[model samples]
Target: MAAATASSPLNLLGFNRKPIFHCKLSSPRCRPTFLMPPGRVPSNSIARTGRTFSNPPSYVLTCLVIPPPPKRQKPKAIIQFIGGAFIGAVPEVTYSYLLEMLAMEGYLVICVPYNVTFDHAEITRRVSERFSSCLDSILGSGLPDLGLSALEVSDLPLYSVGHSNGALLQTLTGSYFSERIPKANVIISYNNRPASEAVPYFKQLGLVVSQMLPVAATFPVNSVVEVASGNAWKLLLDTAETVVPNYDLKAFGSFMTRFTDQLPLIINELAEGISEFKPTPPENLESIRELYNVQSTLLVKFDSDTIDETDQLEETLKPRIETFGGKLEKAVLSGNHITPCLQELRWEVGNVYTPADALGQVLKNVSVNDTRRLATTITNWLDLLSH
Candidate 1:
């Protein structure tokens, strides 16, 4: 007769709040649960072989290693990753995460650090040489430093993934090694504009700096200026703080040194490479196509990436690729030039009551992370082409 309480078994309508259950099936149905999609990788299961520096100091190579998953029964294919201009194999953790994704998917990946020499031809040649040596070391002699004894690299198909200028280098490598290695190449953010076009002031600055202090030209002084002027390391540092907070700061000195030492060489190479995109005779275009006879090529361009030259490049090369019975696939994605490699950060304010809320969005605008979706897109493309 007492007033009903919230926890009372009977409801206001005089019926029990909890409903009785009736089982239709004699036994409960069992359904399968999968932690991840079939054939996809679990992050924690991936293994890594630490970076092994190329012997003989002048070679100046660092092998960025990402071995395959342990449980896979069959041998894995290889992917050679070439970093963008001024970014060597070990510049940042973002690069590491991207490579790890490939490795996690059961692919053995070798990352060639950025070459100081801007000459794409020379860089391609050096990369090819080192790639062969690295392959041999893994298969036959077994380089102890690379933990190659654990891998079986014999006769496996090789593919290439290059970013920015490294994509240019990959193109050259594909052309040069068409017969021997690399079945195809995946080029990201391929920009073919002249270096001066991209940075008009860089040419003038280089000219003035050369006259004012030629000695500094050889000493990588320009690199120091860029860092101090907040042109180079600002975004990198900010991104690292949010995405990879414990990343070592000292590594920046080595990275900057490498970048600064070869600034002039890269500028000169850019000039030459960009000019090749100018109007050429039909015969010249035909000859250029002959040089790029790889089995297939995949070009990934960002929808918002204004710096890309792959559109122009594809128009010229597609015919050549088709002539050779090869295929060319172009994919346009969202974001800017760096979107494939760097993720966008979303910053939100805890409350609007404070003045700090106004600054939160501005700070968030500058933050970045490594784009996992980009890596997945590449993996899917590889799968499509692998068959």
Candidate 2:
């Protein structure tokens, strides 16, 4: 203390010269400004990993668990994502990036692969139970690879986010799961019309033509094509390469089966649900209302989505929902039907997360930006719901 250097603070009567100089140097102008737009939150704050499990009642479901940012505040809510018809049980076409973005905004995201054959509400109920059983284990395990850690989960709100056929399933499942209203319901590109009304005339004609073919009727063509990944199937694919345009032998097999065999069953079930005089409807609007009140629902319509029946559904739901002091909100986003599903997907295998084509040339015009925009729109809508 005999001699204090100029770099060191001069402490006299609790005063320090070096500390005063440091304060003067650090002024408001020296601070960096975040010039990006308010809603453009970075998604790197989240982490995700795929999961598969066999729940009770003989059901197999795949899910991607997206946990919140590390060492930050825990997610305030949970979102159960259901994929649409033909969407695989993987990151392939489920808008994985958008799910990650939602996780970044402080929500535990559970993305479950959907199949057209399964009973929607029943599968949802089973999956919900499975999640409830393993949630505590997932949180307590502290799996850094999965970006998950133990956190308080009591009384956390739950949300259901679905697209296309998945959206309709969620509507029915929403009622099946609980009597209370959800924190929010986000429906994207909702297809409410039955297969008869939804399919194009030419496509419907194509189905008829495909069904008449002896090759399609013989053998379990759809089943083989669906799981056509082994050496034998590859040999079959090569032999029929000229006949079928796609790898799945879709032109020769599954294409017809999907439209002809699978679609009608789904349509019939929905029709029964809507019919006023049906003795036993699978799930009707009145039955849904009795099960649960969807107080706050958000319907997102893609501007170029010709297959969208969101408006029609909204019109039907508004009067019924409003009767119980509920609300329905709509947002028309830009892009076509598949934009929300495959925006961030790559055409080539094993290169997940890389936007396949760049500079205005590709199989589809959907972009990573579309995914971001949808994510931003959803977050903004959720913010409004909270208020």
Candidate 3:
């Protein structure tokens, strides 16, 4: 499969360009603990290329696929993963320590990315679609570059590992992207709070956006600007789009169009209709009691995570998946909700696995150590389920 592409004429915003991602080893938030080669990111043109409308381009990513360390044997399984809300935008960099550690342990890691939106259930649906699309694209064309090296692709077992919001998503789909994905699910620090809780001033933002939509619509517009706003609006409203961290795009076109001030609110109504709802509204969470599907689930709770709703997940998902002959178990790990978001590069003291892993025993941060333990526990559960 060529990976779907859409062509559009130049719009007023002119962000018509493909997106590229960059990560630095020295960044405190980037992965550097494992010795791994540069990642091979497949092309996902959420934005077009060759059209510069004077606006800085934003990338809404489809997905990122990473091969295990070459020194390791062929990948044992495909670990389909997603991280939390904001940090998930940089899954490769944010969760590199644990994800690459899984790769180091000989599993191909497919990290799914999604831009944040208030429509929480819709996020899961879009994530499911994008994840499946990414898998198909990999099987269709990128296997060689993905480093499969003669391993049987179709026969590999699939497991899902998620932290925080990622866990909430996997809970809904059961991470059921393919037949390869088993009934077993691994959920860490699962939370399904209202948009008002996850996003500060959520109701206020929605209210402000609603009030400004009409006023913003009355701002000046030209024929060229009107045509361009449609494209710009679509890009802004695309919930599945993933982006690189930073880019430089100016926000000025003809002085005639002044919608920039109300862009956030205006785009919401354009994309989501004028109605405002929280992410995983009460109705969505209420639906989970009967809507969840799975066979076996491993729920993880952190020692100090106050915001986590593992108890709620257990109360809801345990019965749902179990009704279908599934089992649910829980583990308490030492860390907060943000443990998975912590990144570190270990300095090798002796012979380390990769240049990234420092050798010998060193004083590791408690958070790094906790994350390492979390990775170990999930992989252990995966190994057990594989049998």
Cα RMSD of predicted structure 2 = 18.2
Q: What does candidate 3's lDDT look like per residue over 134-187, in tens digits?
A: 565444323554455322444466667888888877876653333334445778
Q: Tens digit of lDDT per residue, candidate 1, span 275-305?
A: 2322223333344467787666777777678
Worst 10 residues of 2 by lDDT: 50-59
Ranking by lDDT: 3, 1, 2
Q: Candidate 3 — which residues are off by over 4 angstroms?
A: 1-61, 145-151, 175-182, 211-281, 345-364
Residue 63 shift from truth in candidate 2, angstroms: 3.0
Error of 2 at 106 (Å): 2.5
Clashes of each: 3, 0, 14
Task: Please rank every candidate by TM-score, starting with the best.
Answer: 1, 3, 2
Residues 60-147 of candidate 2: C-alpha lDDT, one tens digit per residue: 1234566655544556566777767666233322465666677778776666553354254555565455444334334333334434
Candidate 1 colliding pairs = 88-114, 89-113, 343-369
Of 2 and 3, the candidate ranking higher by lDDT = 3
The true-versus-predicted C-alpha distance at residue 96 of model 2, in Å, is 1.5
TM-score versus the correct structure, for each prediction: 0.64, 0.58, 0.64
TM-score of 3: 0.64
